[model samples]
Target: MLRNRVRELRARHGYSQTALANRVDVTRQTIGFIEKGEFSPSITLSLKLAKELQISVDELFWLEEDLDE
Candidate 1:
């Protein structure tokens, strides 16, 4: 499973979903879904988000333990 630290990062940066999405070049709904763990972004989009949030891609997402296979 894909997990994201979007909510935490967003809170840390004091950014709303819409603002974050705008900075990341995605829709606000996409950011909402990402924060809720309801959607996994493509690599390119993930990179975009990481750049916008001023963090590394690894910091934004990780594989769940059970999915280690």
Candidate 2:
């Protein structure tokens, strides 16, 4: 499954959901959904988030485990 390192990064940067959302120009609910892995963002949104977080897209998201066929 695709996993995101949002919570870790946000904690490292000392940002609450609302604060991070404002910085990324998204809603707090969006951040919450992203953190919970309940929603996958579009490429544009992903790039925006990475840019705001000052990290690469790969750093923000990655495969948690190999998928089984």
Candidate 3:
């Protein structure tokens, strides 16, 4: 499974789901799903999100097992 710190970073950047979604040209629900780990974004979308949140893609998303390392 893919895990992310999207919610935390979004909050730290003072952005609501709607706001972030707008910046990334996606829907608010998409942001919600991403935050909940119910969806995995495409590489293009991931790059856009990382750009908007001022972080790298690797910092934003990771594999579930990566946490065990």
Clashes of each: 0, 0, 0
Which ranges in model 2 have alpha carbons more than 4 Å from their true place?
65-69
* C-alpha lDDT of residue 47 in model 1: 93
Q: Quick one: how many clashes does candidate 1 have?
A: 0
Leading candidate by TM-score? 3
Q: Per-residue lDDT tens digits of candidate 1, residues 1-69?
A: 788899998999999999998887889999999988889899999999888888999988997865547
Ranking by TM-score: 3, 1, 2
Off by over 4 Å in 1: 66-69
> Which candidate wins on lDDT?
3
Candidate no. 1 TM-score: 0.88
Judging by lDDT, tell me the better candidate of 2 and 3: 3
When 1 and 2 are scored with TM-score, the better candidate is 1
Which residue window of length 10 is worst by lDDT in model 1? 60-69
Tell me the tens digit of each residue's lDDT in model 3 across 1-69.
899999999999999999999999999999999999999999999999999999999999998764555
RMSD for each model, in Å, please?
2.3, 2.0, 3.0
In the predicted model 3, the residue pairs found to clash are none
